[model samples]
Target: MLEIRGLHAWYGDSHVLHGLAMDIPRGRVVSLLGRNGAGKSATMRTIMGLLGKATGEINCNGVNLLKLRPDQIARKGIALCPEDRGIFPSLTVTENLFLPPVVAAGGMDIASIYALFPNIRERGASRGTQLSGGEQQMLAIARILRTGARLLLLDEPTEGLAPVIVQQIARVIREIKELGYTVLLVEQKAHFVESLADIHYLIENGTIVDRLESAEFAASRDRVERLLAV
Candidate 1:
């Protein structure tokens, strides 16, 4: 549902992404696999208009987002859950979640979000800082879901998360996929994405260098290992 082509991004005088191109098909989860500094997160940030200057085409469900601002990109049904997990530390869990205006139809109600994250439901009155890392991550994802965003940009969702919490996040991702949301996932944990993604794109330098569909992964496991090692 999202298409990117010839995309480049800059932060002041520093250029990060260069002519990166990729596509996220509808109702499917695609993982961006790469080592650190491979521009996986930069791709996500550029797609979400988080960078100061972005050029080229970023069309979401046919709407061009490269020319849009960060908030404008969000209103077009795209949401980014950054690695840092942005949350309002001063606000209560419930308050932080409902703060962003729902820009589209089908935003999840409180019951629905709470159902996916039971821990969050229980700590509805607690301040954001009072939650654990996992809980904070849940809150971040849930907040975006409430915006009724059709596309989700999840950057390193399992980074530094405990094994059990990673499993929980993986399960929730599967559930989210089944609900028809499109996801572009960035992850270094190959095993975590094994059963979840339909396609895996290997990035290097600043662009997609290779890709393996689900059927090709088992046969090409060694090549993928070598590619990531580069």
Candidate 2:
């Protein structure tokens, strides 16, 4: 549902993304995969309009995302769950989770969220600062799902968490996809992305240098792995 071409992004004088290109069709999971210094996070930030300057085209469905403000971008059914932050620190989990009122027509209700991720409900009383990283990540996903956004730009959802929590996050991602949500994921974990991604883009230095379908990736992970070996 999103299309990007020749994308260029900058952080003031520092040019981070160079002619990056990506295409995300509806109801599928796509990933941007690379080493730590690659521009995966920068690409996501540019799409969400969080950066001060970026160029080229970012179209969600038929709308040109470049023309819209950040809040307007969200209202148009896109959500960015960043690597470092996702929730309002001052609010309780319950408040941060449901504060954004439903905008479009397909959001999950409170009961539905509790159903999909009971972890969130169990920690409802905890402040955003009090929840663990995994809980905050889940809360971030829940908050976006509550907004009726069909496309999720999830950046490193499994980073820094324990393996069990990573598995839990994976399960949640699969469930969300099953429920008809599309995802644009940024991650360094090749195996993790391999499990859930339909297509994968290998980014380097500021642009996508290669791409692999899941089968190709599975059969040839070693090649990609070596490229990311640092």
Candidate 3:
């Protein structure tokens, strides 16, 4: 559902991505794995049109994403749950949940999102800043669901959560897949990706160094370890 070709992005004069290319098919989960500063986040930013200087094509569902503004790209059915969870600290949970509906098509109903995340339902009236790290992450995901985006660009969704919460988040992702959404995920936790990803790409120094199917990825533990070990 998404294709990036020969993508090059720079922060001022400091170039990051160099001729990076990849494709994500409809209804599949693809993981972008790399160490810190490997340009995984930068790739996500570029795709979302958040970067100041980027050259290349980001096509989603046969439309050119690079030509559009960030809000326009989002309106075309791509939602990003960033690494920091990007929650509005002062907004109540219910308010945050309702925020994305303004930009989303068919709008995610409260009941459906509640069913997907019961924890959020329990904390519906609490302010964003009052939630725990895991709760904040859940809120982030729930917010995106409200958008009803067909393609989800999730960056480090499990970054700082506890094991149980991470597992819960993984289950939610599986549920999202069952609901027929395509996901492009950037994750630092290798094991998390192992269980959830259909395909994997090893990104280093702003480029994709290796791409493998899920089975092949699982069998090559040493290769994954060597590439990501810091």
Q: What is the C-alpha lDDT of each candidate?
A: 0.87, 0.88, 0.89
Residue 11, model 2, lDDT: 91
Model 1 lDDT tens row, 22-72: 889989999998888988888988888888888889877677788788888
State the TM-score for model 2. Answer: 0.95
Question: What is candidate 3's lDDT per residue for 148-208, written digit by digit as tens?
Answer: 6888889999987899999998999999999888899898778999989999999999999
* Candidate 3 or 2, higher lDDT: 3
Q: Which of the two, 2 or 3, has more TM-score?
A: 3
Error of model 1, residue 163, in angstroms? 0.7
Give per-residue CA lDDT, model 2, range 99-138, as digits (tens).
9878767888889899988988888998999988888888
lDDT of 2: 0.88
Superior candidate under TM-score, 1 versus 2? 2
For candidate 1, the lDDT comes to: 0.87
Q: Determine the C-alpha RMSD for candidate 3 after optimal superposition of all C-alphas.
A: 1.1
- Each prediction's RMSD to truth: 1.5, 1.3, 1.1
TM-score of each: 0.94, 0.95, 0.97
Q: Could you say which candidate leads in TM-score?
A: 3
